[model samples]
Target: MISTRLQDAINEQINKEFFSAYLYLSMGQYFESKFLRGIAHWFYVQYKEELKHAEKFISFLNEKGGRVILNGIPAPKVEWNGALDAFNEAYNHEKFITSSIEDIMKIAVEENDFSTQNLLNWFLDEQVEEEAQTLEIVKKLELVGEHGQALYMLDRELAQRQG
Candidate 1:
């Protein structure tokens, strides 16, 4: 957050990260209502991770001598009729997040902020992993289709996700 432009970008990202947490929490509730404990557990972990991400940005901004401006996060929708629907939503969300990281990268490059660019490089790689994981979950849900036993088994697999 060396420049005002970068500061604005960081603030916007912080807001997005908070929204991500809320979004995952919504998905957690959706999974619970569907009796998908493993999926719910996964979303819970995701929510925690997003919060951690937000704090990381917040701390970085402060350390860089930028003022942290907190913004209100919109409430996320809490309904997904099936695992497929929920995962499709997650996939789209990851796409949106990837774009956000790309935009930050662009800003870092445009401002010639080598330190910021170095930091953004991490996000660039992280977005790839994020999209891949979400897409994998979507594909798994698609393959599981209407098979309740398979879905449950998959949920159990997801429940083991840590950090």
Candidate 2:
């Protein structure tokens, strides 16, 4: 049986994952409004991936015989200065998520929940990739600043991203 504390923490994480999906979906719409279809597509993929993350947590909770209590997701920002601004937010959010997972990992360790620790280890590695990917885009956007042609090429490159 899952401890109440760990169950509560996982429930909170599930809400956060859902919020992330909503945030990315909002960003996708923002990019679409700016006519940056490729960038929008990238955010759309991010949205889907976040939904999957939430579902993964839900599955884990079920497997552990824990109750899944969902909370409301606050609305995400609908505007950004540009792709760079959006990606910077993304990078920061990933950092926040990493911290959250670490907190949960700490609780798991305290409780001696080896299975939860193993699950969180996967998320920890995934967070590294998530942060790296967003940071890379931020750097590329920095280089492509105010350069329409360069941004266009980058958009084309991003369009090739599959899911």
For candidate 2, the TM-score is 0.98
- Which residue ranges in model 1 land beyond 4 Å of their true spot? none
Which pairs of residues collide in candidate 2? none
- Candidate 1's TM-score: 0.95
In terms of TM-score, the best-performing candidate is 2
Please, what are the lDDT tens digits per residue for candidate 1 over residues 76-124? 9988768888888888988998799789889889989888788778777
Candidate 2: tens digits of C-alpha lDDT, residues 1-163: 8999999999999999999999999999998998888999999999999999999999999999999999999999999998899999999999999999999999999999999999999999999999998899999989878367988887777787788
Models 1 onward score TM values of: 0.95, 0.98
